[model samples]
Target: MNDHDKHIRVHIVDDDPADFLIIDELLLQSKRFQFEVNHISSISEARQELIDPQCDVFLLDYFLGPETARDLLIEARKVHCPAPIVVLTGVESGTLDDEVIQLGAADFLPKGDMTVSLLERTIRHAIQHKRAELELEQMVKRDPLTGLGNRLLFEEILEGSLARCKRAGTRLAVLFMDLDRFKEINDSLGHPTGDLLLLLIADRLRSVMRESDFVARIGGDEFTILIEDLHDAEDALNVARKIIQAVSQPSAIGGHELNVSASIGMALFPENGDAPIKLMQKADIALYEAKRKGLNSVQCFTSNLQTQLERHLNIEKGLRHALEHDHFELMLQPQWDLRDRRIAGFEALIRWRFGSELIAPSDFIPVAEKTGLIVPIGEWLLQTACRYLVKWRELGVSHYRISVNVSPLQLKTGHFVETLQSTLKSTAIAANLLEVEITEDSLLDGHEENPKVQQDLSRIRELGVKIAIDDFGTGYSSLRYLRQFPADVVKIDKSFVSGNGGEALAEPEICRAVVTMADSLGMDVVAEGIETISQLTRLRAMGCRMGQGYLVSEPLAFDEATQWALAGEAVSR
Candidate 1:
């Protein structure tokens, strides 16, 4: 390459015109490096040149008119000039040298000893270093796996895209992708294989999408794709479906074939939300609905989804308030001994009292489970139930147990045992007075073979608390595991008890078999959903030990339950 090919812009700011001309000519004479020298004869001229849109290097003289070169270098910073400033001085002024170096000059050169090679090498090195730094800054914004903009980059770029789209009267699309059953895949196949699968999926998605779209892995098994200039909502949906099909393909790692599906949700710009946070939230809401409907599906954010999101946000806000303010109340429904028609014990049901508004257990339990609000909710229920039972004991009301339903989410938590122990300890309630009611649907998912479901039940049983399989016959109830489970009671679900058309003739035979089965295993049988004398008589005839339903009484608040317990205590006396 020619010397001019490696061109350098040298801004020589000096008080003396003789010193400036001598340096300029010497730089021009160098054959190995060509210098495009800007002779700014004063600090004021240097400041004007610094603001110009150009770069290469600053060869600053130590003294420039009335101000020192250090002062001019400081002025260069105010103009946002990023090039390396090499301070040149004629005299050996140590203090001046130190001040100029500290003031942002890249290097110092004694005017008498300076050579073209030394000056050229320092400027090139500084320029190369600055380029490398800028490149690294750009790389930091990208996801290493997907090579797409990451969350940090997405936030930065989303504003620009929104502004550009709005100016052009266009729309942008944001799609959120969450791989279904990804945890199971990671657990069984190892994380390395899972990571490889994710990379492969990202590649497949990139191949199918437009070049204008950006893809990023936001979380484990979760990715976001942003498409610019998406004029219609259907365009985003089409891309989502394509991604769904692409992710659904079989992946092989170490000779193990893995089949995975994804749930995708999309939100359009200017319509769904005005900001990145709001748009991502809308996509998340749609994603939740997609998962709820079933995986391997795509959902677009509509007014309904936004409404649901608002409602959920309100509920979540209420939940935080409820936890702190003691807005929850416990209701106990009596379980009757089928043979004697005597009250066996009560099942503790949770009710939310938001001022005068009544919130049923069925209303918020599922939300609690999904949001992981169940962990706190479960803790509260266990603690409250235990306290209620202890209070009943203090009032001289003896009871068998207060059964509380445990959500599957609670059973899966690692702190289940500790929480229960703490609750019993705090309330001074006997462990035997507490029963955890888990549903059959939670125990079986069809995909799991030799599941630890029964083992979890056994752990609860080890806690000295009775375990009951509530809504027993509704799930994929394998008789094999049913015989081996650690359940003390099996409450036949309302569906089985009510039967078809309310006749319940077939239900009696089924109930009898279940009771016989429970008896054979030495487990108590509780026929739930009994709402009539005939239902009670039929259950009693079948040798059922306990029955709980609206027939005896619906779930009553703590005060009502206390009154009933007192009345029962009086009757016994």
Candidate 2:
């Protein structure tokens, strides 16, 4: 079918005058069909007329002088003509039609015994098909639910925007937004509620932005908003504030009133970044800062954010390097038996030496935890501590139990029991020597149901690994987890040990009550942060079996700790 077969305009490019006349008469005879026919006898004439934007489809005979219909089709393809060209042919036409279709023609119709209905059908079908294709192409570039550009579309749009900004010397902003505590809501409620909340959030975000701006949800609870044509930093700040207000509005789900908040980080063009990844990265750094400063706030990308992000990246890199190079060191703090007045065990604390600078456990420990470096770091600590136990035995020093603090995230991230078993095998450290301390928050979720935690702790205990509740009374303000778990010891938090007004008076009374409570439960009691002679005396009087603190000496270096261990001979002497 050629261009003239429809109600819309169709260009007819055929050199044969009689065949063109016959086809035109047939189209006219079909009174139900409407078409604007432009007849041309030469390829040059057809190309000129069909090139017009008004031209919809092309009808051409198999052959044109000097330029075969194939040549015209190839040229048409180059010109990006939207029109579909249909070739008219006979015997060779069938074979050539396939060739012509390969040249970008839409379809082919045999000239012999062809009906106007067939011609018209093919023409309408092609137009409808093209329209459908265009629609689908548009949909691919957009997010289905939010109607914002998807990641694929965002890249294309962002590239163009970057180019334009570079040429015009203009400023642009890219805002990275993450819904705070989204996982908590999903776990507490259900996935359906989470989805509903997300949709509501998307709607609210769209309502706040201008038509010139773009927003896209890239992952679960993560979104990127590009604010184009910004006048200044203050303008971008205003948009960020608007975004915070709009998303912070309360969203009701499953008949429950829920308030959701977002952390927004924004980076500007040229100043923050000139590329997509760099821009998004700076925005992400800003978002991290916002989250760190207590969620539900906005942070603009600055050199400070860049520097901090660089430092975190450096730390992450350094950790990986340290592990590869075996640079991490462990310090042991003695866990003393107050009744025996001897070092019964020690707690393994991790430290790092980066060049001449010593990084504290307090600084890099959380960094490791956040970046999932803890899994490896913790494993190393466990193995190294176990190795120390074997070394002490080799040196003929009295054997002592060693305690290690297990991070909650590390516990949940892998097979905790398997990791423990592996470390024991590697270092030949007895299961009884290794004690794992879990905090109260590990079990407390502001609710009573803690089956997973209970089961995990049970499995660890089954493997003969001793369990202790560290910083016991400071968390949850309740004794529910302690009651549920079969913990071997409950270490009183340093806060309680500090005592009121720096006097050991209130502490002894509290320790006496705690000791009494543990006695009732048939569990051992250990006091932490004992510094003064009166405090130690009070603890011993209260029947606390073990204690750890600065009184024994702050967590000491390995050499210092081993020297202190050798001092056991002094006590015997």
Candidate 3:
């Protein structure tokens, strides 16, 4: 049995017969690979063999009768071709290589520089690389625990479905569902049991959906259903009611009976907006309102949610204007060290001044984040905060630092670390004197290791910039990530101090656990929204060293914050 006996099927897609013979001879001369080659001279013939799995790889030429293989490469992708494609170009050009790859070429080979060994290696690597990519794509598109379509898959299907609905003038519905009080169950039963509950819930959801409908698990306890050929918005309501009824049934796992209910918000195509993201947003808004109504209920995108929609639209418009016109303001709130009785530093907060009216961050920040204006806005915030830190250093508080909040979207970009480094350089601020606050979700994006985020955070830490995990306890990340993160400080969310709203007071034990956990991890804890003297007293007793809130004094301008800091004694007012 010779190793050469194993056949490697090759498809040479070039118009020139002489070039195809040369390539065919190259493959045939390989003693390591038994060659079965096919040649196609025109685009019409190439399209027929594109979906043929008999061909292991395609050697595509750059110029095929004045029409480039670039269009063919895109066509291969559109058809979901399985075989790896290697583009054969006459000359080496860096710009053309990038363009071909982006157009879905597996490898770009310059014909003038192509050797037997190089050709073999290129073809072998392309096949292996494509294989690995396909495997990774399958994993990326599915929920690992439940084996259902994930958000990425959901978006792809939603876009395609929306296109079909638009062309056919058919109606479709997007039902965004959330498990009401699922967190309580998850907390009580542990993650293992919670996972089992989710699988059963996923199956129940699948049973409710028709063959034509699509269901995806967008989050740990949230699912989205896409129903095409919808007669009316009421068709979606019936589906939602069926899903609600199915979810309300009891689930048995590990000898324990668990019960959960889903609240669904429906958005119909054309009615809710023609775009995919727009419809999703409408459904999300309706879901939030449905959640407000109680469990096992359904709400459609209607005039009731229009107020929020209008507000978001207005804020989006205002945000674009503000970013262009430099209408944003930065304010600093003092953080007092509980034990030392000195001002620790100030956390920089952003405010948007729209004409004469001052809009709260609560109203605009989320809008900014959704619109992806956060990245540019975040850069401005960091640069401005570092400048303020320089001002504070000049005001005789060199040891005190300034903390600026960063959205997760900002950290996802690989260039964020460069932004941080440049800001430090431009402002001439000490690295340790400027801190970047990243949310927990930023550190861990749905249990996947985000290399870009981790790399940026690690590089920022190496530059001596202080890293604080902002809104620590309120996020969906696990406690075990504390050791993995390079954070120097953990700012406990205001909800932990303010009792998470409503009349329900926060237990001291819950607050103590977080402080103790951060302490064990060698991270300093800062309590946020410390409005009450009683809350400050409790946190101090709990060994929390620093805090910032209304009690520490509301956000102040440059001169006022400096004056407050220079007061030497911590003022309650």
Where's the lowest-lDDT run of ten residues in candidate 2? 442-451
Put down candidate 2 lDDT per residue, 12-107, tens digits, no spaces. Answer: 789888888878877676655587787889987666544343666677887776678887887665544557778887554337767987887778
Report lDDT (CA) for all predictions. 0.76, 0.77, 0.82
Q: Model 2, stretches more than 4 Å misplaced?
A: 1-172, 176-203, 210-226, 247-262, 275-277, 291-296, 337-342, 395-399, 412-416, 438-458, 469-546, 563-573
Superposed Cα RMSD, model 1: 9.3
TM-score of each: 0.61, 0.62, 0.67
Largest TM-score belongs to which candidate?
Answer: 3
- What is the C-alpha lDDT profile of model 1 across 1-573, one tens digit per residue? 556548877777777888888888778777777678777676766665564426577777886656777677776655445566788888887687688767777778898987767766777776776567547856997788767667876765666566557656889998889999876666566667877888888888889888777787776678888888876888888888888888899888768888889999888988998788899888988898899889798999999987888777777777778988888888888787776667778898888875677766676776677689988888888888888887889888766589998876776665777788777777778888889988877755411422455566777788789988888766655566576677888888776676553644337777887888888888888887777777777777778878877766788878877776766521221
The residue ranges of model 3 lying beyond 4 angstroms of the native Cα positions read 1-171, 178-202, 216-222, 228-232, 252-260, 274-277, 292-294, 446-451, 476-479, 500-506, 570-573
Model 2, global lDDT: 0.77
lDDT of 3 at 522: 90
Give the C-alpha lDDT of model 1.
0.76
Q: In order, what is each prediction's RMSD in angstroms? A: 9.3, 9.7, 9.5
Sort by TM-score, best first: what order? 3, 2, 1
